[model samples]
Target: MNWIWISGVAFLLSFLAAGVLIFFGKELEDLGITGNIYYIILIPLGFSSAAFLAGAMKSYASFTSNESVSYGKLQLTGPIVIFALVVGGGFIMPNFNRKEQFDVKMRIVSNDRPMTTLNEGTVTLYIGKEPKTVNIHDGEVAFYNIPEKYHNRKVRIVPAINSYQLADSNEVLISKNEDYVDIHVTRTKESLSTLVRGSVLDQKNMAVVHALLDFSSGLATCYTDPNGNFSLTVPLPPGEKAQLKVVTDGITRFNEVVTISSTIPIDLRIDKTP
Candidate 1:
């Protein structure tokens, strides 16, 4: 038997199998196979395949050669060498290509000024359902070990503070190499209150006097004045959607969702019940 040829063939087969395993490792993980268990099962299968091929080749060579072949103590040398190389490389190669991790720093600001009063709060960064939260320190917070894939992707940053309307900013773009981000927040007299001023009118466009307006499931409720004008502050920040229900004379007039963007007055028209 040609020992060199057997060794070379076994090495080639083992190398190709290892490459396939590495390529599909992520897919395997998604299929609920963890890395340790995955490699544990696949590596032995690869090694056995290589050893079988080497043994078959050795048998064929022995059958074809007319001369009497002598049995050697190192008969399984080819398969043994391949197993050693595969197992050793599996442990050694990861050190050369470590996954790159990043640290992201965020500075909180309100009205274009760094917030000095906000010394205690948590800032959460979300990429889909995965959230990384950090406590604010000196108006700044940091997230560490952010994966490289999140770079250049859009992420939502939300601040949790008391007696303040923390705006959710989804326009934050995670830069490829940049680590610092600036977030602007809004402060309100109450927790995330939006001043909504609007008018209630009938189908005839006449003022609907004494009509009751409920904002955000009664978070803020009030009645329209004689001029059909109403004003209330709802507990919601800008760009948030809230339900607004209007009632007059024991009849539901208007029930729908509205986006709170500004204090600009909106007109709500409904048909009067006979």
Candidate 2:
């Protein structure tokens, strides 16, 4: 459910409940005198009105902002409050500077397969001089866009990854295991330390970190080379996890499942196993 809609509904319900109690309950009338019914009704109405007005003011402030707000008194939260007020105050403020204030480029590439380089094609929109496009050797579209812009400025092509999705309204039920059991596997090598110095000292059997993926299941099989080496060039499989066994002769064994991602190197070593 949308939080904003939920909040609005909850506020409306509370206001209605307060109104009902004031009108039907004798306790409310007994607490006050005759002709004071107006006061009773006005109090709640004033609260509701103030709440709505504050929300409106906040919304209005959000749209308006000055490069500077000159206020004599500065409180600890004055800047934050001013920011909130400008954002919520329902005003549109323009940024005066236009000299490449901030920018970002999205580069997409198929590391496993061949595709066109992102730099090869004509950038459809306001691509910078050296815009970073997906570095592909084949035919995969790569694009980016400014998340927020002052005007309807069209620039980088927005890719599927940049789009947002709203989940369905139906209640979702999910079950997951809270506890996990470790399995045993073996590996030949391990890194000496998490912060590895320049190179392993005098080690020929040293293994460079490499990832093996089970194509059928799309799970990553990661193990560190007792050699302490890793490769960042490998491509990630489009799967939820990796499934593989780690074992090495004359070395420790670890048979456990670990989450997989291309962003982090697979550096599990049997020697480090406790």
Candidate 3:
């Protein structure tokens, strides 16, 4: 019996055992190794096991040829690290972290009515523990990449209200008695035009244009469409200065400020010109 043959068999068996333990050993109470520790130990066991198995194959191959078998740990390190990130543990961190977190509360009220729940709501933190309440529908809450310090904190949001009723119109009366921002989205206008006149040999320049009715409290986003064609009816927070942002085809086109009023119309034009 060749020692190399015996060693090969032993390594294979040990490797199989380690794999099974990793897959189904969650209840292995007495097996001092568990979780990451189990995997860490199995790492070295796996390498040694392979070395033994390869030693046998080499012993046979070497006698047939002058070539020598060579192995290195460097080859395994990259794969192990990648496996840990994608399979062993990193994937679960987001869900687990959310559950372990303490959340903040945001209160949102709208002018439409005292809705049991808001259509949207968000909190904006300028600094420290203090955060301002912005209506979710105003598009303020869509901001991502909140600093880590503000992560998991809750925001309070409220909508705007109208104070009086119109005499003879289908429009509902706005209740201004409550604290909220007044926001109404109406499609105002749309148009199309050319930025650059294409010659017989040039690419055609076409623009889809739109006009918008924008109103909010503090933030206002205003811009003509890139092609000067389209308009938007974006919700505004209740204040004098507000931020405005636009999205077309899942892309954020622009961000800026403007005074939001019932009188001014926001315009956007998306360029289709190549």
Candidate 4:
């Protein structure tokens, strides 16, 4: 009975945790906790495994004891079974008879003209762990029968074209029904001109000149001028986050992630190196 109570408590706690994750998953994701579908399944399975082990230990102890084994001593099975059923049903019941599908439509344009480069390029759309790739045709492509589970979720669209690069707007929110996404690409030579301007300052509120700024693993790099101003273009679209590393006098002073929001100059302040 004591073991049963312990197992029951463990199950309840796990259930509560899973509930929080399910209900507030998006909020948690914003805070960097990747509460994806896998976590939802893993959490319950992990707790159930622990409960099963506890019950097994109790059975072993009882069998080895001088006291005769009784049916009442096996009560741990009740909560364990119930927990398993509830969890399994919660995940499995949703997929049963779920034939709903969604469609995602994409339109590609290059230099303000409809892109008809089927043989020259392909676009890949990623929803969670699933990736769908389709060749661009007639300036458009459509993905059909996408599982309804991904409705309203965010997706990443990447376009691969010979001598052409995506200009802007990659990540998009998938709609509940038919979704439409627009992508723009430009020639590689014409793409590198989107510049991001910024400045680096030290603890004394003074400009840190000669500071090296690297973005997207050196996809773009520049050093601060005498007045601590720097400008370099990155290969990422707007609204995408990139890793920004700042080195001053050959010593890394600031290393952080930054979101590419706009052309407005970004001001970064760091502690002066000793």
lDDT of 1 by residue, 216-244 (tens): 77788999999999887777776678788
**Model 2 misplaced stretches (Cα beyond 4 Å):** 1-226, 232-239, 250-252, 271-274
Of models 1 and 4, which has the larger TM-score? 1
lDDT of 4 by residue, 1-274 (tens): 5655665676676777777877976555434453255346555555565565557453222313335665335434544555556666666776787688767787777774446644557788886565777777777777765678878887788888765777876877777554557677787874434568888888888989888898877888899999888877777655567889898767788888898755667799988766
- Note each model's CA RMSD in angstroms: 13.1, 24.8, 21.9, 17.3
Q: Ten consecutive residues with minimal summed lDDT in candidate 3?
A: 193-202
**Superposition error at 194 for model 1 (Å):** 1.4
Query: Which digits, one per residue and each the tens of the lDDT, describe model 2 over residues 38-151?
Result: 334434343443444445433222333345764333433323454444343323232233222222332333323233333343222234464333432233332322233312
Error of 3 at 249 (Å): 63
Model 2, residue 34: distance off in Å is 47
In model 2, state the lDDT of residue 150: 15
The predicted structure with the larger lDDT, 2 or 3, is 3
TM-scores for every predicted model: 0.35, 0.21, 0.19, 0.33
Model 1 lDDT on a 0 to 1 scale: 0.69
**Residue 59 in candidate 1, Cα distance off native in Å:** 83
- How far in Å is the alpha carbon of 34 misplaced in model 3? 30
On lDDT, the stronger of 2 and 4 is 4
Output the TM-score of candidate 4: 0.33
